[model samples]
Target chain A: AQSVSQHNHHVILSEAASLELGCNYSYGGTVNLFWYVQYPGQHLQLLLKYFSGDPLVKGIKGFEAEFIKSKFSFNLRKPSVQWSDTAEYFCAVNARAGNMLTFGGGTRLMVKP
Target chain B: DVKVTQSSRYLVKRTGEKVFLECVQDMDHENMFWYRQDPGLGLRLIYFSYDVKMKEKGDIPEGYSVSREKKERFSLILESASTNQTSMYLCASRIRDRSYGYTFGSGTRLTVV
Candidate 1:
């Protein structure tokens, strides 16, 4: 079975600090990657996705992810963090023609203002 | 914008009681899914539907069933709600191409007592 791994369980950052969350998946095939964010008491929203072409994908709210096929990684990054960016981030992947996705353990980010 | 709506924000059920978690999507998507989010386990898929009246078991489908009588609605049922089933349930919808990210609902937090 395919699985995703997120290296960080919880991360605390001061405002304006750089942010990066590591994600690795155990799948060896054409894959589609995604990043989702869940704000406090809010629903999960798509941050970004990678289907094909570009390896680096930019998303809303200054978020971005890079799909590195060789390393099986799709790491989420932000140049600077803000309090509003505090949320739980999840990394998900599915086979190119697969119907379901496998999600990582998730990284809980706390941005301190 | 796509919208996936779960029927409840929170629910409390007794053990051994039947529980139903409802979800509806306004985008007329071809795929709908149910997932349970835990602190460390992340989002574990419970079930999924590709079309009306069609359902497939996911990674964790034991003790759970699903219904999809219409294209816009999907329901997750717990035959006998157990304390271990307490978690946040999320509903999501996606197009058939599998190129885009999923649109998720606000989630229903179910607690069995």
Candidate 2:
């Protein structure tokens, strides 16, 4: 069974601070990675996705993720986060044949203004 | 804008009552999924359908059932609601290919008391 693990439960950062949320998945095959963001009182929205292209993928809202195959990690990162970037981020993974996803325990990001 | 609309935003049901949560998509997507979002659990997939009337069980499918009679509509059913089953349920739709991102609904928060 494939499972996703996020090391951080809550992350607090000041405005313009660099951010990195760790995500690791337990799969040894071709994987599709995704980052979903849930703002306050809003539905989950896809920030970015990586299917078969380059390891580094850029997503919406100035966010990006890198798929490290050997390490089984696809961590979300941003150079500078704003107060409006405060939201819960979730990392999901799906294998080539898998239609559903395995999501990591979300990381709640709070950017202080 | 593409939308995946859930039937209810909030629901209260008894322990032995049958609960139904409906979802409709306007994008004419080929795949739809039902997931439960908890505080520390991220989102757990309950069921998904690739085509109409074709359902597949996800990671956690013990106490939940689903119906996909129509292409644009998918329903989640709880035969007997329990306290542990109380959570925010979300519905999402995606295209046939994995490259497309999923569009999620606003979610339905259910409380079994």
Best by TM-score: 1
* Error in Å for residue A105 of model 2: 0.7
Error of 2 at B12 (Å): 1.1
B97: Cα error in model 2, Å:
0.6
Candidate 2 TM-score to native: 0.98
Runs in model 1 deviating more than 4 A are none
Clash-forming residue pairs, model 1: none
Best by DockQ: 1
Predicted candidate 2 versus true structure: per-residue lDDT over B1-113, tens digit per residue: 88999999999999989999999999899999999999999999999999999999998998999999999999999999999999999999999997677899999999999
Tens digit of per-residue lDDT, candidate 1, span A6-51: 9999999999999999999998889999999999999988899999
User: Please, what is the whole-model Cα lDDT of each candidate in the order they appear?
Assistant: 0.95, 0.94
Predicted candidate 2 versus true structure: per-residue lDDT over A1-113, tens digit per residue:
88999999999999999999999999888889999999999999999999987999998889999989889999999999999999999999988778878899899999999
Stretches > 4 Å off in candidate 2: none
TM-score of chain B of each: 0.98, 0.98
lDDT, model 2, position B63: 91
Q: Cα deviation in Å at residue A87, candidate 1?
A: 0.5
